[model samples]
Target chain A: MSLAKRIIPCLDVNAGRVVKGINFLGLKDAGDPVEIAKRYDEQGADEVTFLDITASSEDRGLILPIIEQVSSQVFIPLTVGGGVRQVEDIRTLLNVGADKVSINTAAILNPQLIFEASQKFGSQCIVVAIDAKRAATPSGYGVFTHGGRKETGLDAVEWALSCYQLGAGELLITSMDRDGTKSGFDLELTKKISESVGIPIIASGGVGSLQDLVDGIKLGGADAVLAASIFHYGEYTVREAKTYLRDHGVEVRL
Target chain B: MSEIVIVDYGMGNLRSVEKALQQVAPLQSIKVTSDPQLIRTADRVVFPGQGAMPDCMRELKQLGLTEVLLEVANNKPFLGICLGLQMLFEHSEEGNTHALGVFKGDVVRFNEAQLFDECGSRLKIPHMGWNQVEQSMEHPLWKSISNQSRFYFVHSYYVREKEAIASGISRYPESFTCAVARDNIFAVQFHPEKSAASGLTLLENFVQWKP
Candidate 1:
């Protein structure tokens, strides 16, 4: 079992441009999605994800041209999310070369969409992106929907298990509480979900440094670690993060 | 320029495979098509697939491509990727579907009941990432690449064969066939296009291979 842990750099795109923000709040332009993704591919990133931060709020499909550009330039797998509502939407994205389509709010509204999409495509291509935050209630963490604004009063870990059972091949658990904070991944949040699900878990949100990446895998048991602000802001290169993780005994593609 | 048609049965992501081929052999004529004659007569055929076995078989049958693909696989220089490798078997537990049966094998799901060793390192299903691939036997595709070179893989099911057709083996939770080779046909359970430079070299070798 030599499956090396993955290091993915996420690009938060809005209106066709990559943007950055703290904790998913104030948004600012980062760079072009294609250029950043291409750089990461050269840097030996395992995969790249693009989240359309405003597509659902604006009620439109994300920038297909941008996805086209990124997919054409980047050889690695590309997963695109945000505003992906239906099976048709997933087909459209896959047609345009997006390797996988992620669903957040829509999956919450219609849990069957995950099964349908996974059935239509393969489970390997279906990724259920869970935006979760610490809840004040007994469940401890709540699943957030519609770009982290609306909260579904469901236990985050339970939702993850159900999503996997419904054929979601992987789970991208984003800690809304730690998103953009650079405090590192919400290890506790990541650990809880990773322990609950059998599918691969991509620990997302609150990644500030390379150590945070290693911690996501070692401490939280994540199969992959995703970051936006740290990689987007040029605080660290994908190469540097991969090197650090490799040096720390984490198997990463150099 | 050699004619290389990457069979497109509407099953998996074909672009990365298409692009990787273009990058390694820019002068070759590569087309992603379901056209029978094009695939049957191409100098090289890349049967790349992802998704469910039933869906792939269904699309192949629906598109009237099963025979054409079989003809190409047996006669031409062929490379199958992931589900492409599985579909060559007799059956797959996924969707409980019959396959092309080009190879005498069956596909089974990962044994998750006891997914861990005594050391307590649990193996995840879908086996998603770069894992070391040990060369099982010498082949032209292993040229210029080391024996234990890692390739990217994303699969829940794997191929099990009785014969020594496996040219490369990888241990996910156990030793499973990662690659297979026979005269004129080669199949792999990993995505060579996504396996970085080493993968590129394999594709290049395939392009230049005579056998």
Candidate 2:
């Protein structure tokens, strides 16, 4: 039996609504997070990630209701990230039916939070997201926080190793350099981190085509591939991506 | 319609399981609870959990569910998922935790040395993501789900059955028991709620299954 790779469709939500391309051609409501998540589920997405990009504290509570609504209807794993600063945030998300919580800045600020959160909630639910950019550091990729606007000066590979050691169940590695470029995932960055750690790695950032998803697993050595624009703007269905990956000899859950 | 009570010892997310059940058995009442009395009164018991085995055992004890779960598993139609499956065995390699010993097996962690496929590529631990399960025995829960259907799995340790109770097996570079069944008990190493259609089919079968 083969372990099929996963395809996750990420939804950048703001104020409890899906952001990043609010003007999709066919969606009844582009901003409805639940509708978008349900659509992804219907498309056979392995998992759906909701990145809360809300800027204000009052808007932060918006994601909870959205997650609760989605989890009730969509029968799949939902991972919520963005603005997860403490253990309470993780708890709040999990309680509302989020299967996993991704911690980025808070994890860098207090690596112990990873340890504590993992110890308390089990590492399976704690995902550490690393935004890496091409740099002149020893590992050649430096970790960036605050939505890739702030550089932590931490070597991406070294930091990945430490995070695994600190009890992160999985790592979501995103390359800031190729994030919006749509060229493809930074194969070098994903390969280095995947080879260094024993946990599963989710390759994110740049995904312009179906071939990029294949490369994320085959060449980049990622266990899962996350894409937004590729599936967001009605460019490609999640099924099409999986079908391409399967034809290209990559195991997917289609 | 019978009520299905999901044991919640504060382990992992149960809403997904509860919601999935609601989808399949809309008429049946499904409850996510830690109350021993509520669990004992249910027609079917769902033991769902995640995290470290030691911590799970501690929480089960703290909630005084060790005896309650054992009693229900022996007497009623019980469904276990993930850690719920692992906790049925006699012992687990994780933190050297002792399980409920409902079945004759040992929960062992996957050996790092043997985690390589035919291509000689090393496999990651936790065995995260979707994997195909080869049916090993006949069971009602396998209804409508084709043999060797893919299911979502995310765990480091697996069951090494000392008896012939393994109902399904999956290979993570090496073959391991991913499902077990005996009498009224059905347990799986993967999450049916997160495994898409085939997984939902399994849960649907469980809802209508007599055993």
Candidate 3:
């Protein structure tokens, strides 16, 4: 009866195959993106994200075919990120059935691209992903690019506000310091950006336990939570996460 | 063996809708086109849209689809999704544009102040993700779907209208009309193609529905 908080299972795909060292029981093909996405859909995941971790531009084309296959089988909103640089990339992904495209480095490098893409493709399909790290800035966080390798010296909160004003429908805020560490999400960073934007924010990066998911919504003020390793490695199913969120009275779809 | 046409005014994701229909009715002829000839001859029509209402209306007029869509929606078994539903009304608060006036209503944006849940937490705009739809009335599309099925929704504005046409209602903070039905038309604010199994079931029912 209410708009439930979303739990998104992110698949770190590399060169057309799902990578992230996922080890699911009874999953015959671990690397298949379509099969993996379907599994998440069955687990009642609100949405599925495929972050193409492929480094090279040439290999980046590989994710297109994978998205084409997954969007056909998995009847859920599919968001594709990683290596999304130009407006052409967003168009191609949407043509192949990507429900949304997350722009990270391209957004920081050319903020106009967000405005143009959102205008052409509609802001509903445009997601601005910000990789933020703890910095000595006034907002306490700095925007990072190149998969958190380079700092842009821009205050994360200010950048988030600009992205929204630039017509970004949603923001995918990731904590670089907490990512892969499994400690927890940067609740402070997430809250700052969430409060700054009128649009929805997805708290990403560090999610060690189900409590982290609830905290992202309850404490961090995120509309949704995204995680990789936890769901990838079968440590927790998306269903388990939603159930846990429901137990915590977060109003999940479960 | 019937032809199902998806009216594409060059806005949202039509491929997903086509793919979803192909999955449900593999043998059925489904075409995505802006050409009125293709749409006019089709047995069914799916009006799918996203983006600003002004853009959608401008495109529909540019393509000369305003009358064609009105004709089809009146006679054929028409299905509208998201902006498609909004455009069926008289006007939209989005872009402050005039719509088709197929139904007696207006599209309004969610109030920022009234978006708090019972827990007092503020709800996000666009109202993205899965939300439970409470069926307000019985229809052919609700043949196999349950009463309170979760559907994938992503929108900022909703329809404000009389209760006579409201078929399904979902809540962000309070109950709002999320679906409308009258005669041959069935419009929804949620994307059934992206609503998982229950959504597929609804589409299948639509494909098999004789009415």
Candidate 4:
């Protein structure tokens, strides 16, 4: 039998600590990433993903010590993203014990980079991240890159399909419009891309309650669900999320 | 003082297992040990695993644990979790790996297409979460546990037993075996340590169970 569903808590690292904000405004420091990750691991999170929101803009390498500290503390899988533009960056992340490396703006600029990285480290090691926002001009959503600063005018659903074809083993799709709003996930957006791709899809953004997570999986058709504010500010824990999912008939690691 | 020896094969979640067992039994009685002699002398043993099945089985053989594990399975209470449960199967489709052959049949990955059809919904891979189990109440390990309670699970592959060895089953897009038991050997695909109160109670029952 296949394993149950997983509850994942995402941490956005700006300057070595967890931070959260609506529409990326009024950034507030949550806590140390390592400490927060350890708590989630203790609460039974299947895995944790860390996004260095400022690493690319700052032109600095990944915070290796932080990654090392967290990896040593938690036994579950860890995924690192942001400022990961080249194959060497992926190598560095993996060497630091990150189970997977997620690429966003860099992969958009060089689509073939996905194929090359997958070939070097295997497909399972590569994750393609797509940030999307609703566009008024086209009356639909388009892909956004570079921390949601650049709009590609490309359809979000189509971009996901292309990323998979380019050898991305997994996809992390975050809705910029819905992010931090806590209204609920963009189920329509998640469903569109999920239906078009075969690889694992991690639905992110606008998660206010446990029902949002279950709705994302059952209605949006996502494989895994990722939340930031709910987990970061202690609105609920990984254990509570899993229990809620279990009660709702959604499979999750208890 | 009944002692429970958790085999440390240098892979997977070791601390969580230790913590869960401690919550169920006395912390003094649960010891995470890599020493084969300690495991052989323990009243019960737990084999926990993550990652690929072949690598884990190889490490067990390299540490000369195959014979020790078989002896424990034959004479003592043996519990397997996740990849630990897969290792007890005959073989695994992952990397074409061969298992301990303790239970007949092979471990295989979930066919996503088939699962979607069965559940009428898109199913994700690497199933992770707290899920409900359809279990037989007669099993000692499940004593006092109701049918509505859930357990934590994280795995991508499952066992396909030749004959019925399962004592409990869970539905995830499709019905699948969640727990298996035969003779003195018992295994659960879910992680009791991660599962919270219901899971902790299951472990406590196992600690006090006398077959």
Sort by lDDT, top down from the best: 3, 2, 1, 4
Say which candidate scores most in DockQ.
Answer: 3
lDDT of 1 by residue, A1-254 (tens): 46788988887778876767322112232365666677778878898898887745553455788877776666777899888888988988887878878888899999999989988888888999999999864558889976578889988988999999999989999999888788888888888888787889999888877888999998898999987777666678788888999899888767
Q: Model 1 chain B, TM?
A: 0.98
Winner on lDDT between 2 and 4 is 2
lDDT value, candidate 2, whole model: 0.91
Tens digits of per-residue lDDT, candidate 3, A156-247, equal 99999999999999999999999999999999999988888889999999899999998889999999999988988889999999888988
Which ranges in model 3 have alpha carbons more than 4 Å from their true place?
none
Q: Kindly list the per-residue Cα lDDT of model 4 for residues B6-71, writing each as its tens digit.
A: 998866546567766765666558888889999999999988876667678888988889898878
Whole-model lDDT per candidate: 0.85, 0.91, 0.91, 0.78
Q: What is the RMSD, in Å, between candidate 1 and the native fold over all Cα? A: 3.4
What's the candidate order when arranged by decreasing DockQ?
A: 3, 2, 1, 4
TM-score each candidate.
0.93, 0.97, 0.98, 0.69
TM-score top scorer:
3
Clashing pairs in model 3, backbone N/Cα/C closer than 3 A: none
Residue pairs with colliding backbones in model 2 are none
**Tens digits of per-residue lDDT for model 2 on B1-211?**
6898999988877888998899889999999899999998999988989888998999999999999998998888899999999999999999998999999879988888777777666799888888999999988899888998889899999999899899999988878899999988999999998887888899888888786
Location of the lowest summed lDDT over 10 successive residues in candidate 3 chain B: B117-126
Model-by-model DockQ, in order: 0.65, 0.78, 0.83, 0.14
Least well predicted 10-residue stretch by lDDT in candidate 2 chain A? A17-26
